[model samples]
Target chain A: MTRARPLITDLLGGLVVTAIGVAGFVESWRMPRFAERHADPFTVPGLTPGLLCAVLTVLGVALILRAMAGRGGAVAIPILEWPAGSAQRMIFTIASVFLYGFVLFGNVPFLIATGAFIFIFTIGAELLNADRELGLLPLGVGALVLAIVAAFAIRFIFVSVFLVRLPG
Target chain B: MDGFFQFLHAVVAIGLSADLFVVVWATLLGIVIGMIPGLTATLGVALVTTLTFTMEQNTAILVLICVYIGAIYGGGRTAILLNIPGTPANAASALDGFPLAKQGRAGEAMAVATTGSFLGSIVGMLGLAIIAPWLAEFALDFTSFEFFWLAVFGIVLCGQLTAMDDPLKGWIAGFFGLLVAMVGQESLHAYARFSYGISDLEGGFGLLPVLVGAFGCAEVFVVMRQEATHLVASKVGNVLGSALSSFRYAKTWLRSGAIGTFMGVVPGVGEDMGAWVSYAAAKRASKNPEEYGKGSTEGLLAAETGNNAAVPGALIPVLTLAIPGSAPAAVLLAAMIIHGLRPGPLIMITQADFFYSVVAMVFWASCAMLVLGLLLTRPLLYVLKVRREWLMGAIFVLCVVGSYAIAGRIFDVWVMIAFGLIGFLMRETGFPVAPMILGVVLGPILDNNLRRSLSISQGDPLQFVSRPISMVIAALVLAIILFSLPPVQRALGLVLSRLPSLSRKNGDA
Candidate 1:
């Protein structure tokens, strides 16, 4: 209905860009130019990154100025208010993804971790839906069946057909 | 003539090979993937790229091309049945497509879309087969300085074209991607520039993981954050009749296909723009323009054909110039590099028949799509009914596998997650991700060439302007920048507007 203001997001994003640019500039400047090896100044490893850093800093300042002037840029990230219970679902999904990739992966058995991830994620998503009536039994059973089929299919394709090695 | 006949022989051989089955199956899978709401053609191709790592290069390339063609054509299914586009390219189709569906002619609309896509692909294939090698031949004269300018031109033009409202944001995203590529050890010198002592960072971020994260994982997050909509279905019609009827408006097909192919050849301008522009042109030329938004088969055909034709259009630059014409083409370019099939000016001379093989692949993919798109329209629509809960879960699994399978490294998976988060945030803030992806793809080329050119010129900045090819490219880049300025554009518009009257007065004299 109403337009969400992007002022805060733009301001924050500009600051982040400016910070990254500054860091990039400093780190690039510190990099060895290896002048003794008779390398051309233009071919110095830091040249492109350093140039990009300066450009990024300038753009960030421009973004900040536009935001301060009340002109349209990134006003506000609507992450907080996509729909009822959306923010929670998004956060949950992201966390589950990270956990699957980082913590569970390489540490646990490949099939078990993948199967559990699919099952839990599916059930978790259904449980988090605010508008739906949660049916635990069907949801659990469905998640289980889908996860088994998916995990096996993935293994068959990647491990068998494609010959990619999955870690336990 | 000899080369052409050889090309035909190769095509015949490939046609009879077992890989034809791969093409058929990949097309069907691509259609199903395209019909899904959260899935995109770019992601489909990227996922397939990971899967193709172990296959023979030719078979792998065949599958990827089929998937690419199928997915782009298949997005029309949702655009017609639901008011939602399965991908950004299908957005234009949804305008007239949904109306046709609501009128209980959904099958007719699907049939028209399939026919339009087939015709568009045919036209684009012709362009690729004819024009691309010529362009590559011409580009053989390009020097280091010319390449530097071309790279900059690509980034700037891409930023401006993809995000008209905020070209600044697009430029920033593009530059950021370039910076990301600048990480790890330098190619010219072994100096570690941005690694900061992290061993994993030394190799830089692999393109596959970042792509999977940005397109795949980010999609998962975006989909999960929204409530799913219900699907609507319609009955069948004579597929041949609906397809043949599109020929009644042959002019629309020709115009739209031309526009789509041309748009595809332009570096970074892609199918979404092709569809929108073609739809607008068709509406403008129509005798009954009022029917455009209310179930006009011509409008639907224009959109579908334009987007699909752009597919070949996008590949033109990738095959000849090593610059991608679209996001999906970006992945395709990456796939080429992964398969050791380098695409650039030297490609024609080094691997002469590679160009013909690509053309053959496009031709086969289009034929496969025509068959599958018409026959399996309803079954593909059935995929739209699959719940978001299950689909997103499956996608996440694929993302994890696709990212890790590239290098069998866990860090790449983390990279995917990180980029996915960044992509999600960037999308929410209206920064276009395509330019950023291009930046990463082109960053090394830009850096290596710029340094080489400057080094060759002994740090003479004027060398960039003095060299003929570089000067021309530099002028084009400058022209693009100037035209992007509102004041300059207005002044140019004024001059252009007075030209007709001035011409008329001269004619009278």
Candidate 2:
């Protein structure tokens, strides 16, 4: 993409970092010192976190100033550089994940929730793949079978064998 | 002499027992995990740690150690067959290995990797056995001042090395982790700092949940976001023959093993650097440097050897000082504590036998990796072909359960998702996640020692720089920050640029 993408990221990220630093410092400073209990002054609970937040605030300012000077480079990790034309797919995945984790997981029965999640995720992802060979009906059939086996097998192993006591 | 017998006894005890079954299966599982493009050794070891919660202490450590060693070695298979490295440690292997595969020499590349990995593990095992006791003895002299400085030194050095181009972001992530650690109760007064009357916040974030989210859950998003990969080579030609002939590259593996072990000993640097530096070093010393990146066996061997050697090398600090040398080692250290075994300073005096048992575990795991890698080379290719569409759903499910299993708390699952999003954002913005995890691991050590030392010295800042060891560590931390500055780096680049010309002129004269 364009060089300006990282520049924008840096600008936004710098602001968030500064915000977190400022808020963290205020919270740390508000912590009790235990002076009333005759505790050691040097061992006050606020001292270490306050110092860390102050340092963080300085670094955040540096990042913002560097971005303002137009000196930040593009994202450097090669593995993290995602290819383009996948926005629709990404949105689908994230939405499905949020639905599963936030709404479905703890609210429904374990097997039903897990199996339905796997089925929907598989069918949805396969439909998004342009190179797919399977028809939709066949894909759904396969996904249903796979999801059932996986849900039962995982529940049996974790709950019966390892004895984890998984949530609803 | 006595140590040798202790090591020998430990080896035989494990060798003749039913633990051999556990060793092979754990290593095989590790190999499968590493062969998957999105699965990292850290995530593999962390998830397996959940499975070992009810296991006996030493047995649990044995299984984790096997998984750790096996996973690092297993990633080389993906590097050769597919262009993608299974784990970051095998990124260097992908350079020469994919080329070799394209040339119909994939079997040879796999053979070279297996032999090289085994040799590297042996060298690192020797280093661990010989050096750990002495290091533990030296650490006994460390007081709170030294520990405080040590903690700072780890964070700064790790941040600098992992993100040298952008040390500012690395340090920020580390400090943020430390701030996250401060949310729980303070040890001195037991007064919660940032809990805000929430009962769950008083307990702080669980390390496993954060780790699983950052590495495991984040990986699911990253995998689904990227374009899919394919395996390029299907033919497994004469693997055993190439395996026998790969022994001729002795000098390359030996050198790479030593280099990898050194990198592993450096906190937070880990196996990725071990592979890269070893590959570069091998290329420089090669008779035909042009052959590199064009299917050079020496380069592939060096990469594999270097990465595997770092495994045992990373263990030294974990056993001796309770400081992990890498991310996966960080999980192993946490697993040690969760299993009720303490590591640091007094290990040699109190837990010497257990230390020897760990070395034996490494040795057996390396052997298991070699045997399994050769026998299952063909069958394992099926694993790489599994569609990400079908696989990621199950993987995310495991991530949720793994996080929940640690404490049976639904809040931890929420923590996992939160960190997963944060980790995804951090990666998108070019911030490395290793330093953040290292920061989490070192947080308590830094906080505890910082307050304790200050109380002892009654707020005399001079005391931090007064003792010899503490002063030396402080100086090192200063030097790292100074050298990371733009001006200092520019100056060094200029000087380094001139050195090559100066050397050439001297040779001509």
Q: Pick the candidate with the highest lDDT.
A: 2
DockQ score for model 2: 0.63
lDDT of 1 by residue, B46-123 (tens): 999999998888888888889888889888998898787888889999999999888888888999999999999999
TM-score of 1: 0.95
Q: What C-alpha root-mean-square deviation, in Å, does candidate 1 show against the real structure? A: 2.4
In the range A15-124, model 2's lDDT, one tens digit per residue, is: 88889889989988888877788989888889888888898888888888888888866446443355554776778888988888888888888899999999999999
- Cα deviation of B157 in candidate 1 (Å)? 1.0
Please report how far candidate 2 places residue B9 from its true position, in Å: 0.7
- Give the proportion of true interface contacts each model preserves, from 0 to 1: 0.74, 0.65
- Pull out the clashing pairs in model 1: A5-A75, A5-A76, A6-A74, A6-A75, A6-A76, A7-A75
Best by TM-score: 2
- Badly placed stretches (over 4 Å) of model 2 are A77-85, B494-509
Per-residue lDDT tens digits for candidate 2, residues B1-509, read 98999999999999999999999999999999999988989999989999899898988999999999889988999999988898889999999999999999998899888888888898888889988898999999999999999888888877877776789888888788777778788788887878899988888888898998888888888888888888889887778888877678788888998999988877777888889889999999999899999999889999999999999999998999999888999999999999999999999999999999999999999999999988888988899989999999988888888888989988888889888888877887888888888888888888899999999999999999999999999999999998988889899999999999999999999
Give the range where candidate 2 chain A is weakest over 10 consecutive residues by summed lDDT.
A74-83
Local accuracy of candidate 1 as per-residue lDDT tens digits, A24-112: 99888888888999878889998889988998898888788777877655223555357657878888898888889889888998889
